[model samples]
Target: MKAGTNLEKILESGKFAVTAEAGPPKGTSAAVIQRKAEMLRHCCDAVNITDNQTAIVRMSSLAGCVIARQAGVEPVMQMVVRDRNRLALQADILGAIALGVGNFLCLSGDHQKFGNHPQAKGVFDIDSIQLIQMMKQMRDEKKFLNGDEISGDVPMYIGAAANPFADPFEYRVKRLAKKVKAGVDFIQTQAVYDVPRFARYMKMACDMGLDKKVHVLAGVIPIRSLGMARYMRDYVSGVTVPDEIITRLEKAEKAKEEGVKIILDIIEQLKEIPGVHGIHIMAVGWEDIVQEMVEKAGLMPRPVL
Candidate 1:
């Protein structure tokens, strides 16, 4: 069992794994992270503690992971290349491992221009693909990116993000292929609102046998209101919310309930796709809704492996 994390165990055991996102608070309040972690504890195998997501500075993901562990939930620590150089990245990986963080998600973070600190310069020392390769080497060979030997085991269940809903659709699969080749053990894609398009992406991935090489978890975000839906459809990069969803929410008496129904329907449809190993719910600020969504989707009673 690679890393022996609950996420890896659930996926390796062939169960439809469920993972969720938990954004850290901007301040030093551990209570906020603890509350979010408690809310998500039983709903998902693990929660992703985001690292300065959207280029907005926040509590460190490593600290959040430790707090989430205190809340009795496993955490998938997210590391972005935008904020740190290779030395910092490698050092943080070692630090997180020493703190018992076994799972990681590598990402090229959002641009600093969009964040609270617009003047901040991005380090982008290495992109997400190289980060994956580096983590894999650290885990499998006990070696650093510079090929120096490590004294002890660096066991990590490496993961990376994918955007199947992104433009130039044909290239999405190829990009995922590169990550798999880079030795990522799992993938969590961009939020999926256009099911047909996502299915096509999966078909292409399956044709290349990418599913067999790595666990692919289709991402879904629960739409809360018409404004949110429209914003995601028009503004969010790589996310494609369908017009039908917007129309439904537009006319619904209770948009929130309708939104929940939409997410459940997407879950049902995603389960039917061939290469999908699981679902990753990104509720954004609505972390409290994850338990209900997971339960209503019949993904509850998370495996004991």
Candidate 2:
């Protein structure tokens, strides 16, 4: 098999790219991970293995990426810098690259207080932007942190996250622009329930002429129930649920069916937005519904490269 970077190709082609995340199991069972990867293999351009997502300890992101790679699926190794210092971050990136994982998503990670280990110390040794710069330096300049020249480069297609719905939306766009300027190859935004609001953000990016410079994948998470909708609206920072959507969920006879319908509607609207490079589905625990949503959205599985 030829070595290929699907995420890189998708960005280069300027087409909408589709990515899905697969959470690792708490135990050592590869069955769950493999099943999730296999289910999304034909639908997603790449599978992102989240690193201790939500600060909850689970299987290692690196291990999950290796399994996905062995299963003939492209893996996006997510690196959270919160739990690890610069040394660990660099070491993990090198290890993942050595294991045939070329795509990465840099994150500052969830706070330790949000996890089971609330007493654990938090380490924000390097922010996501600095991490991206570091990776670029390692890959392009073949230089290490200590100013030592490395023999070989760690070829990687780097990605970062943005939350347009966060407080003071203008600041979010500005922050994302900084990440792009720092050499982030691609970005996956927070779940955007408000299409009009997201369109405004896209317009801002276009006005700044940053839209053409990097690939932006709008994140979408399907709402399973009215209760879930309420939770998201109340708790999830940077996520907004429209009153109409909530009412629709409240009136629906079946919440799951309604949730799928809502996501389908979102995809329909999102597809027409200019500067939208792709959609990233965060169907947390609802991976089985991804194919239906993808087909409903009329997206085909185009190889990234």
Candidate 3:
């Protein structure tokens, strides 16, 4: 399983592991995050702590994961190369491990221009694939990125993001296979409102036998209203929401409920697909309704840690 946490055990046991994510607050406040994590206490296997998501400064992911752990939620800390050089990245990993954190999600963060501080210089010393390789080296080889010896233990259940709907779609699966070869233990996809497309991508991954080597959790974000759906379809890059789904949301009298239903349907369909291992739910600000969504989708009552 390459890990020692409940999240790793759940995935290692071939269970339908459920995970959720919450963007850390911009301030020192912890009440809202704690409350939201507590709401998912018994319903999820892990909660991803995003690192400076959208390039906007916020609470550090390592600290957020510690908070989540105290609140009874396992955390998969996210690390992005856009904000850190190798030294900072490696040091943070060791620090996180010292703090009892085990899981990680590597990413090439959104460009700085999209963030609040556009003038800030961005750092991309390594891409996501290289980041995964670096982490593997630290854990398996017991050496730093510079090949220096490390005395103590460093282990991780590594994860990486995949975008099935991205442009030049033919290359997406290949990129995923490279990541798996680079020691990615799991894959959490981009927001998927178009399951058929994602399934096709999975088929390619399965054909190449990537699925056998890594766990894949299809990403989904429940749309709260018609406007939300439209915005995602139009403005969200690397995500494609079919017009039919938007129409369904628009015509429904209870949009919020309908949105939940839509996610539930996606889960049901994903379960039948060949390569999908689980679902990664990201409701953004709608954290309060996650329990309802998980229950309606038949994923509640997660196995005891």
Candidate 4:
């Protein structure tokens, strides 16, 4: 049992795991994180604290994890390659472990051009796969990236992201295979609005036996309005919002209710997919809806691991 985190245990115990995202506030208030943690504590097995998601600076994910842990919710802290070099990355990994953060989601973060500080330079010293390999080495081999010996256990459950809806669809599964080979313990994919395309990606992954190698959690975002749906369809890279869904939203009197129904339906379909181990709800700023979504999707009463 790697890391022995509640998330890892829930997956290992063969129960369908549910995870949700909680982005830290732009300011330095720990109270905001505590409130978000309280909201998500019972709705999911673990909560993901994002690391400067979209390249926008926020309270550190490590600090957010510590706050979430204090608030009685397990946190999966995100580590992005765009902001820190290997040395800094290693330092933070050690710090996070010492602070009792047991789960990690490695990412090659969005470009700085997309964030609030567009002029900021990105520090992509290592990509996500290298970060995964480095963490695996630290945890399993008790050694640093340069082959230095580690003095203590670096226990962690490592995770990475996948985008089945990305271009050159055939390469998507192959990329996932690479991450699995690089020692990713779990994966949370890009928001899945086009279920058939994602299903095909999963089918290809299952055919290659990748599912046995790592846990795959389908990502879902509940759209709140027609504008949100269109934006996701047109602007969000690696996310495909189907035209039918857009039309449905356009015709609906209550777009929010329709959006909830769409996610509930997606959850049902995701549960039947052979390779999917669970779902990761990523309702970025609209965290208040997560509990209701989980309950409506029948994912409540998360396992006591």
Candidate 5:
């Protein structure tokens, strides 16, 4: 198959596009990573390789993306500027593009204090917005951050993160609008459990004109157990699980089955939302469940554009 950036095509097609994330292991072994990527390749438009996800050390995102690409899977190279300066970020982008990873997700990343390396320093060298601006400069102006002209520009399908369920939910939409104004091609939101609230937020986005300007991929993370549900409720910021879901999970005879059913319900409702561009399923370790959700939701294969 001819390699192409499905993310760009997804945006242009004006239809929903599905994407999923795969976190590379901490060690050098690519066996688990490759297996997961291959499993999700046919189910999603592209697979995102998380970079040092949650500030925990992991295989390099670029290397993982390259391995996925070699396996006939389109890769989204995640670039977290939280630990690197502008120079390092720029260099990694160029290298990834050369290695055939055309999609990029810009993140500020989690604070190091939350990770195992509590003593390690955090570098917010540039906030996510600034990083997006820098990427625009490199792509549109063909100039380095130091003002030197580059031989060529890097082509990337730019993506950014959003949390619609964050506290003071109204403010999250406003922030997302700012990201869209800052030239974000797409917005993959934080995990969503409250469809009603998410629907309202989608309306807000449409009202702000963001719906027309940028694609929005609703994030979904399946809750495997009651512990997982509670962790999200109490610990994970920007994720809201209703009492109804908790009740269902608590009463379930089989936790995984209940979790998958809940995700299917979420996806079904999301498919009816007008401004929803697609779903980005974050299965975490349950990557295998993605196909079941996609199949259950009746999301067809990537429609030719």
Candidate 6:
């Protein structure tokens, strides 16, 4: 049942798992993806191939996974419910697994208004929770949504996203529990800039013992520059960038190294938390710095998967 994914094997061996994310190019260039994956190789246990994140069009996540795999990086394929109907979603799942993708992260996706196509209609055919359950059925029961048996096997490691800093913050842990009950094997949360808030969220999850049942990987995005920090603070919701971080970014002579240091400090503290199983570094367009950050955090040359 282990999907033969390095990530699954790393976590199964009880090592602190590290993962990164990469967006496939908007054009048909798998080479671009392969190059990025090569940069992240040996930097983390696996790389998450993002689906048209922010609703901007790009190569499919399935194709991105193929490129990453060919580059020798394990991938967690992201699936969003915003554009695909039930049939398309299931079809992609089948197709992705057939093409050797073994891990997935189910998402409700950002609304289309945020991307290039503001006029595109949204598809909420099924929410993310339902998608999680559907995949669980396919993998565990070896059946599709219509209850038809799969020809050979349905092997997948399912994950869900959570935002601890989002509104109704008091209920974030409960929402995570819902995902766990619905069959999430692992979870990757939104960016963590507030140590107190993240600790609170982990405390709650630990209280319920959800941490023991599922892997919880905290998300961290290195602040590339003072402007980037300000941009995220002003535009991104559910993300908290402390004024201290902003001040540090503003004062640093070398912004990128300072950013890496800040994130390294965070990773050091995050690893000590009881429930946090790993770190998922979202390098965004700054993929070049991921391995350095991981290395500084003492997670370098990643554990074998």
lDDT of each: 0.93, 0.86, 0.89, 0.94, 0.86, 0.90
lDDT minimum window of 10 residues, candidate 6: 296-305
Q: Estimate, for each residue in 1-305, the C-alpha lDDT of model 3 and write its tens digit.
A: 46688878988888888899988899998876798788877778999999999899999999998898888888999999999999999999999998889999999998988889999989999999999999999999989999999889997999999999997999999999999999998899998889888889999999999888999999989888888988888887778999989888988999988888888898899888888888898888888788888898888778875
Model 1 C-alpha lDDT per residue in residues 251-276, reported as the tens digit of each score? 99999999999999999999999989
Candidate 4 is scored at a TM of 0.99
Give lDDT: candidate 1, residue 114: 88
lDDT score of residue 280 within candidate 1: 95
Candidate 6 structure quality by residue, lDDT tens digits, 1-305: 54767788887778999999999999998898988998899798889999989999999999999999999988999999999999999999999999999999999999999998989988889999999999999998989889989777878999889999998988899999999999998899998988888999999999999988899999999888888889988899889888998999888999877888888888999999898989998989989898888888888777654
Model 4 residue runs over 4 Å out of place are none
TM-score of 1: 0.99
Model 6 lDDT, full chain set: 0.90
Better of 3 and 5 by TM-score: 3
Tens-digit lDDT string for candidate 2 (1-305):
11248877776766678889899888898888899988888888898998988999999999999998887678998999888998898888888888999999999988888988999898998898999999888887888776678676678898999988988877878998999989888899999888899999998988888888888899999788899999999988779988989999989999889988988889888878888889999988888888778877888755645
| Model 5 lDDT tens row, 7-26 | 77876677788999999998
Give the residue spans of candidate 5 off by over 4 A. Answer: 1-4
- When summed lDDT is taken over every stretch of 10 residues in candidate 3, the lowest stretch is 1-10
Clash count, one per candidate: 0, 1, 0, 0, 0, 0
> Model 5 Cα displacement at 9 (Å)?
0.6
Question: In model 2, how large is the Cα lDDT of residue 102?
Answer: 91
Q: Which prediction has more favorable TM-score, 5 or 6?
A: 6
All candidates' TM-scores? 0.99, 0.96, 0.98, 0.99, 0.96, 0.98
